[model samples]
Structures are given as structure tokens and as C-alpha cells.
Target chain A: MSHSRLGRRTLMLAGAASLLTAKSGLTVPARAQGLQPTTSMRGGANNYRPGAPIVDRIGGGGFLMHGTVRRAGDGAPLEGVRIQIWAHTTEGRERDARSHGATLTNADGVFELEMPQIVPAFGQPHGHLAYDSGAFETVFLRPVMDSARDASLAAHFVLQPA
Target chain B: MTLKHLRAVIAWGGLATLIMIPIAVAANSEYLQYRGPIYIAAGFAGIVALAVLLVQPLLAAGLLPRLPIQLGRVVHRWSGLVLLLAIAAHVVGLWITSPPDMIDALTFRAPTLFSVFGVVGMWALLAAALLAAIRKKRWLRPQVWRFSHVFAASAIVAASVSHAMLIEGTMGALSKAALCAAVLCALIWTVWQVKPWRGVRRRQNSRR
Candidate 1:
């Protein structure tokens, strides 16, 4: 066999060995393992949390995020939680689900979307929610339960930079 | 083996390449028409690559006899190359199309985990290929190469599956759910075939 070919193989083997050794006991980051995170809700520039936008059903007049947020150590309903709702849409092949603008919470810590319908270039119909003013732009908004145990469904929104 | 099997592998690899090239070109262009289809195409490639990676170990252990060993190896290598090329094309094309994503891939935070998975797969593959080329080198024993190759292959498969699961935009609708199922099944099959723990059990039983 050609020395050059052998050398190429040797280099490859060395690299593989090193990678295997390095990764032996180390835990690969979730991202490295294929967990893609979406944009997060931003509480100003300081406290940022990854926000995974979920669908929530609106009750009566005001909008509500309807999901529970808790402290790290204890699982308690983080009362007075403020969630910012941003909304927008694209036409189909263009624009994308970019955040158009944001809406804040009221006394009940609920946010109602102002624009129900948006017309972007080739956009699909979707909504996003940000929690705790953290950086997480999307969240898994759990549906509020009714007496019938059915999911109350409604539109959600996102806030974009101007 | 039969000539038909060889033909099939080549054809599949060729078809995958054909599907991949346009997506690359489209991704790289600024034209409005190129965006949606390429996004869809990249998603398909990811699913296919994950499937192939998941099946490779089973095929290696002689679990899939319907596939010829040589053909299996060829399919694995070629499919891997196609996946890598598609990713590179997607990245380069997207750079032309979406510079932010290109930056995200480099920075290791591309919103979607696909970029992270792709990057690791790429590096692992490159190393595996290099070592396989030099298997006869006296200093690098065959056993060492074998162990490392197994680990790298596992990483590639695991990363690819994770990337696919995390992605929201690609493979939307029922197709996405189906792809997820396929990945999970293949992963299960691969782990079973490898049976990395089997050796430990055998040793323990003997000691007992």
C-alpha cells in the first residue's frame, strides 16, 4: 500500500482515538446530542430564559398564558408570573414566523393578543409565548382545564424588535 | 451476492444525491422560490441519514442478511457521504441564503439541534474514514480501531436522532411523527444488535 494512504489512515485513527478518549466519561451537551432549543423570552437584557411557546385557550375577555412556572428548588405555582405574548405570521414560502411585536400581562398576569390575524409572505399559522420576561421565546403552554376536562384552545402571539 | 442488490444500493445512493444537490443550490440562492423546498429537502436528508446510521451496526453484525455485507458497507459509506455533502451544501447554500444560520452552526447554537448533530457526525465520520484507510499500519492495532469505530458510529447515530427530534420546522405534519418513530425503532434495533453488555454478562457467568 502507498505510504500516503497509510498515513491518511493513521491520522484518521489517531483523531478517532483521541475523540473516543475525550468523550469516554464526559457527558455531551444536550445541544450536541441533538436537542435544538428555540428562541427564549427576554426579561430585558439581564434575566433570559428559553421560552418554548405553547397554545393556550382564552377565557372570557382577557388573555392568559395558563401554564405554571415554578422555582428551581420547590414546585410551587409561581404566582404573579408575567408572560409576554408575541404574535405574527408568514405567507407560505417567505418571511417565516418572526416576532412582529409583544403584549404584556394585566393584574391577573394574563396577556391577550392584540392582532388575531397576520399576513406575511408565504407564512403558516402559529403563535409564540415568552415567560417570566426571560429570554426563552417559545414555551409549552399547557391548556387550562375546564369542568369537562377539555383543552381550551385559542391563538397566541409574539413580540418583535422594532 | 446478486447483481440486483448492488444496483439497488447504487440507485438509492444516486437518487439521494440527486435530491440533495438542488436543495443545496436552492439553499445558497437569494431567489424567493428556493426557500421552502430546500428546508423540506434538508429535513428529508436528515431522516434518511439517521435511518442509515441506525441500521449500519445491525448490518455489520450480520443481522440483516437480506442485505449483502459488501453492499451494506457501501450503502453505509455512500449514504454517510451524501448526508455530509447535503449538510455542507445546506450550510454553504444557507450562508448564501441565511447568514444568521451559518453563524449559528459555527457558534454551536443554530436554534435547531440539527446543526450540532451534523457537525459532530461530520467530524466523527472524517476520523472513521481516515482510520479505516490505514487499518494495516502495525502501530495502530486492529482491535483499537474496531473499538473506536464502534463508539464514533454510536455517537453519530445518537446525535443525528436527537437533532431530528428537536427540529420543529422540518418534517412537519404526520411525516415528522413517522420519521421520529422510524428513528426510535432503528436505534432500538442497533442497540440490541451491538449488545455491548453481552460480553460483561458472559464474563460474569463464567466467573460464577
Candidate 2:
């Protein structure tokens, strides 16, 4: 065989051998599971509070996450509720030093958050929000779908009093 | 049939079969079952990337017997383009599915080691493609381009292999490891046979 032909044949044999080896079911020991979070949930944790400046910085394609924080028993809007909103951006984490902060509900117990463009990361196109009030149970909202295109997401927090 | 023709048929058949493994494995993986369309797309993209990696070195080294060296060069260029597209699809799919992790990976803040390796590999692959694209227009010396190409290729192979090995995801473990090993061996073998370093040394000696 010519040198070129020989090289080709060697390549073919290597490919065949690799395929056969793959099919042979030579298993490696399985690693311990459950250490890593699902790709969507990774880096989902955020404790940064949103300030007025941060909310002002939300630009086009941004949406309002506005809803009443109500008491679970009688469904009355609860006042002075602290709400934190964070979502993925094209740059970095929403709650990173560059874009970190939170807001509070008004006397009517209505809170609104201006979210940046929803760029999905980890698992799906989603965002994170949390509700906290001194007299009520704290609620962490995770992997909230970015439904901005349709309508503003009304994430009502029905908290049980602590 | 002539012996040579028979040999060609077997070789092509074997190569085709080898190419199908990653695609088949991706389609059948349990992790992809409940992951929705975007995730499934990413899985398929990753499989295509791996498959491209397998063929690239062979084409570059002109190891495909039936193809003339000129044809091999054409195929290699097209393969490089396909590889870039596959990688772009993979990253976009993953980004749509999960922004935080993708952000972490891109920003080099990802906690997982595999994410770091994957990001580095991706950048290296992109840089290699860019370098190849601009080589003629930039009037880069052949020796400089060759060295840069080899360095970028080495980074890509090393980082991608490590990234794939550490992640236990959609790919079948046995097939994934086998394919990775094959790719690494082919890259090392091709680089060794080409002896790119010799050109660099010769150029330096002439410059002295």
C-alpha cells in the first residue's frame, strides 16, 4: 500500500477500535451524587438589597414585578414588607456589587420591582425574589419564570405571621 | 471487488459508525428526557461539538485515505466552521436555560471546576477559529500562525477533555471517555508528526 493508503487504513482501524471499546461496557465507578446543584439553581442564592438607584438602572425590556404582600389568614395587604428582586443579566449576577439592592412595600402593602432584561442562566429563563417583614414569615421565591413579555409577574407573598 | 476498494468501504463505514455514537448517546441520555427543548438542544450541540473534535485532527493530518490533501484542507476549513456553530448553539442553549451559571462560567466566577475548564476550552476554540480566519488578511508569518494555532489547539484539547471528563451529565460514561481519549491521542499524534516546533526553531536559526 502507498504511504497515504497505509495512513488511511491505520486511521480506520483506530476508529473501529475506539467504537468497539466504547461498546464493550467498561464502566468507570460512579461518583457520589447530589453535591452539585442542578445547573439552573446554581448561584441562585442572593442576599443583596435593591436600592432606588439600582431600580432606576433597569432599562428597556425591563418589567415590573408588582404585587400586594398579604397576610395569609384574612388576605389583607400587609405593610412595610421588604422585597428583594434579582435576575440574570448579560454581564454578571444581578446581585453582584455592580447591581445589588432591595425595596419595601408602601402603606397599601403594594411593592413593585423593576427587573432588567431576563437573560436565562443555570436552568431556564427565570429570576429570583424574596419577601421579608419583621412580623411575618420570610419567603424566598426561586427560579421564577420571566413572564415579562406577556404581562408583569404578580408574585404575591401570602405570609403567615411569625 | 478489488482489495483496495473493499478496504475503502470498510474504513468509511467504520468512520461513519464512530461518528454516530455521540449523537445516539445524546438522544438517549436520561438527563435530557425532562429537560425541555432548550436543554435538549444544548445536549445535542455538545454532542456535535465532540463529534467535530473527533474529525478535525484526522482531516488536518490528511488521514482520510480517500480524500486528497487539497480536499482534506477544504473539509478541515468547513469542519472548523461547523465546530464554531456547534459551540455557539451549545452556549446559547445553555444560556437560555440557565443565566446565572452561564454568567458565572463566562465571568470565571463559577464554583465548579468543570465550568471553568469548559469556559477556557470554549474561548480557546473561538480564538483558534478567529486566528485561522484572519491569518491571510493579517499577513501573519506562517511560523507565527502555526505556533499560535498549535498552542490554541492544545489548550482546546486539554481543557475540553478535562471538562468533559469531570462532568457526569448526558454523555454515556464509557463512550465519552473513549471518545475523549481518542481525540487527545489524535491531536498529540498529529502535532508530533507535523513537528511544528521544528519550523519555529529553523526560523529562529535563520534569523540569528
Candidate 3:
């Protein structure tokens, strides 16, 4: 075969191979690329809880993220606020296999969460934390690696009354 | 054993191994333990469904050297039924595990890209199976039936392969990718061999 013909064949093969393997890589659309705060807040059957302790369920690095929730208007500490956290682990995405339960804020509106270490294959290192209090507008916090590494992250969330 | 018998044995053995490897890899995945039995079973079913896709093109094209064409057709028919069952189990298992997610997937409202491909593949597979079931009635013209069958089959192969490749699940990535690539290649090669497109073009030209 001529060099030009061989080059064309190589290009065709390359295109086909990319099409076949495209799904295995990062292919999420630009619109849905970021953290969907509102949609991500809805806890699942296993994860939703009004007042569940979460310290035991978290695994991986000793990284901890604690925060206080308060009302946006009056700035009063909001108790009984449901909080859920999920992230990629060394294995893969947090499926039903992983324990990603939701918990409620204590009387002081305090909450602490242990972050899971990131798996490079799982893409970006980030954690999704959602706050739902039924009486207030739900809030979701997308904490990156920087925030997760902080010993006392002091992450505070403000929610508006619904 | 005679040479012909030995060849048959070897072919069958190779086919069995090719089919079982994906299931074995999926069963051994550590994530299966975490996801529980239903999830594990669902993943296994999906793997089996993809593996079944590999057998289909070979059977349809009569490429299985050991089996007679008549026997191959019988096996192909039964394999189609098995594929349907596996898909049903996979979908039902997933629905039980997460109803909302399943609903989102079915309705095309799911945020995950893989869900869209998977749902499309599922529907295409169903349409193909339904067409196959009613094909003997001759309700549709031969050309129409053949066109619809090939279209549905292509959709199923493309969408399912994309769906499987996109999802990061219990199935080992290397094995999953290999199986998907093989299925896509087989379907493409079979379609080329069959040349259904040429028949469709000829029919169109005759109408003109």
C-alpha cells in the first residue's frame, strides 16, 4: 500500500478505537459537569435520616470536615438539619455498596464528616455534602480536596426558610 | 476421538470460555460484596447480556464451524430468549435497589450519561426481540422486516456497548472493555458481510 493509503487506514483505525473507548474516560457533558446542589440534596432511602450519627460510616483518610448550619435570615443555628456526604473512594463511585448515610445537625447546629480518599481513576477529588431541614431550603456543598484536608474545615452552611 | 470430533470439542470449549470469562471476573470483583447480592446479580446479568451479544453475530452469520446452520439457528433463537431474561433480571434488580434512579433512567431524566445509553439499548433490544417473535407471521414485507431488524440490532449493539463502557461498576474494566470492543467489532463485521445497506439502497432505487 502507498504511504498515503496506509496513513488513511491508520486514521480510520484511530477514530474507531476512540469511539469504542470514549465511554471509559471523562465524557460528561459541559452543562452537567459541575456539582448539582439542588438535585444532589435529595437523599435516598438508605441515606436519608433526620438525626443519624455519621462518624462510624465514613472511611479512608483521617480527614475530617465539620460545620455548623444556620438560618440565612436570622442567623440562628438550625438543629435537626439532615446532612448527607458521598465521594469517590479508591475503589470507585459511591454505589449502594458504600455506606453514605445522612445525618442531622445537633442542638448547636454542629456536624462533622470524615472524607473518603480520592481514586484518581474516579476523576476529580471532591465531596458532595447536602443539607436538608424540611423547614428550610436545602443546601448542597461541594467541598474540594483543599477543604477536605483541613483539620477543622469549619464549613458553615446557611439555609433560607421554605 | 476422530479429528472432526476433536475440532468440534475444541471450538465448543473456546466458545464456552469466551462466554464465562466476563461472568467470572464480575463475580470476583470486590465491589460486589459491598453492593450486596441484588446488585451483584444485576451486574452479572448485564455482563451475561453483553457476552450473549458476541454469540449472536456468529450465529446469525453461520460462522460457528462446528454447529450445523440448522442447529445454530435453534441455538440463536434460544439465545435471544436468554438475552431477554437477563435484561429483565438486570433492570428489575436495579429498580428494586433504586426506584427513583430507575425511573429517571427510563424517562430520560437521569443525570448520568450512561443511564441514557443503557435505557436506549434496553428499548432497542426489546423492539428487536418483539420483531423477531412476530416475524414468522409475515405481517410486514420481507424488506421492511429485514430493515427494522438490522436497525434495531445495530442500535442495541451500539448503545449497550457504550452503556457498558461508560459505567464504572463491579465488572473488571479490562475484561469489560475487551468484551465490548469484541461485540462491536463482531456486529460491524457481520453487518458488512450481510450488506443489508446495499439491499435497502437497491429497493429505494427500484421505487424511483
Q: After aligning candidate 2 to the native by TM-score, how far in Å is the CA of A129 from where it should be?
A: 14
Arrange candidates by DockQ, descending.
Answer: 3, 2, 1
Q: Candidate 3: where is the Cα deviation over 4 Å?
A: A1-47, A53-82, A86-111, A115-128, A140-161, B1-17, B201-208
Scoring each candidate complex against the real one, what DockQ results?
A: 0.04, 0.06, 0.07
Candidate that scores best on TM-score: 3
Which stretches of model 2 miss by more than 4 angstroms? Answer: A1-162, B1-11, B202-208
Candidate 3 backbone collisions, by pair? A97-B34
Worst 10 residues of 2 chain A by lDDT: A32-41
lDDT of 1 at B15: 40
What RMSD does model 1 have?
A: 16.4
lDDT of 2 by residue, A21-108 (tens): 7688453437532222112234445433534233444444356667767776566776777777766543344545443446678888
lDDT of candidate 3?
Answer: 0.69
